[model samples]
Target: MVDSIIPKPKRVDGQITGLAGELFVAAELLKRGIQTSITFGNAKAIDLLAYNPDTGRSFTVQVKAIRKKNVFPIAHNKINRAHTYVFVVLNKPGEAVQYFIVPGTTLEEDPDRFTHWFTDPKFPGFNWRVLQDLGHEDAWHVFSEQA
Candidate 1:
């Protein structure tokens, strides 16, 4: 067995995969006539920022991507009301990616009970289950909602 402290190659792929997802999100939003741009190098929690020039609807978008077509984990600290999340699944190479757009508040809310999980730091393994359960699959209206 070889001993080396260098991180595995998969780690680098993950970073590129993440950036690919962010680009895909930006492209989709732009295609839909939403003014969108990626935050260079993701210096902030937001990966993309979008605005509907006509209505001035805007969102601070955080994108999460996974190589497999499954829900991805989001760091608990990154959830916020002024934010929207774009979940992406990188399909086969050169194939179109899949996306699920959801609002941050929905991440925290239990619509039936009026409770939330996003603001709770106690939760370490919080996935996008709540947002998924809300049927945000490709739901783009969350952006226009701010208008």
Candidate 2:
């Protein structure tokens, strides 16, 4: 009989997949004409910083990518300081993905807690409406307008 539950990928593979996915998403954002950069290390919770010359508004995008769509990503801090929180959902083989943009205020009102696997609570349980499915063309249009 086949095993119903699937096994997780090795740690190294997981990291590599995550890195590749993030880069792909970043490129997609840039192609859409949003000035963007990916920051490293843990000093700041935000991952990608995007700016719009037209609106002159800076948006902080925190990227959380999950392998499966049914499973969502979560953040403990609730992005009180960022203008926006972006959850990038990815599928295995690292091709298909979606973006969820949640306003900072929404996260600000939520509670935060610590966990064993991850540090914070309320991070992995994101809502659905916030999600926006994106491809090359759609991503470009939305980000360009947003910027």
Candidate 3:
């Protein structure tokens, strides 16, 4: 029923999906009056940079996105403690996008505690569930606090 409620895209493009997620997060941050910019590149670690002029504060964000509700695969070595993470679910056309805002320190502190690592020798990355169980959906206040 949940799957049915959220439609799936007919085709998936990794590049487009990733860019869309970054844009969506940027838009949300802008809506909250936070100045945001997307750092575009294949090798870039930080996707979005947000600043709050009122507080004179700024922070980096790394975005991970999927077309539907599923585990986000990430390399354990890539987690940066100074960056905040935003896991995005870009469901389908007409469906609302879901965002899970989490601090990178939460993952870097103890990755195994929050992610499921693949046992395969070739593909040794971990899958993160995006703190859904912890109720981090739409946690836009994270930026406010950081500010």
lDDT of 2 by residue, 12-61 (tens): 46555556556766787677667888876645666778876766767777
**lDDT winner, 1 or 3:** 3
Candidates ranked by TM-score, best first?
3, 1, 2
Off by over 4 Å in 3: 1-11, 118-130
Give the least accurate 10-residue stretch of model 3, judged by summed lDDT.
118-127
**Clash statistics: count for each candidate:** 1, 3, 0
Candidate 3 matches the true fold with a TM-score of 0.81
In candidate 3, position 69 carries an lDDT of: 75
| Candidate 1, residue 64: lDDT | 83
Cα lDDT tens digits for candidate 3, 4-113: 78766678789999999999999999999999999988888689999987677898999989888776766667778899889888998899998988887877777666
| Top lDDT model | 3
Report the error of model 3 at residue 91, Å. 0.2
**TM-score of every candidate relative to the true structure:** 0.73, 0.61, 0.81
Query: Would you list the C-alpha lDDT of every candidate in the order shown?
Result: 0.71, 0.56, 0.80
Q: Which has the greatest TM-score?
A: 3
Error of 2 at 42 (Å): 4.4
Q: Local error of candidate 1 at 3, Å? A: 20
Estimate the lDDT of model 1.
0.71
Residues 50-130 of candidate 1 have per-residue lDDT tens digits of 899877777788888887654465545556766887788778888877777867776545333212333345653334444
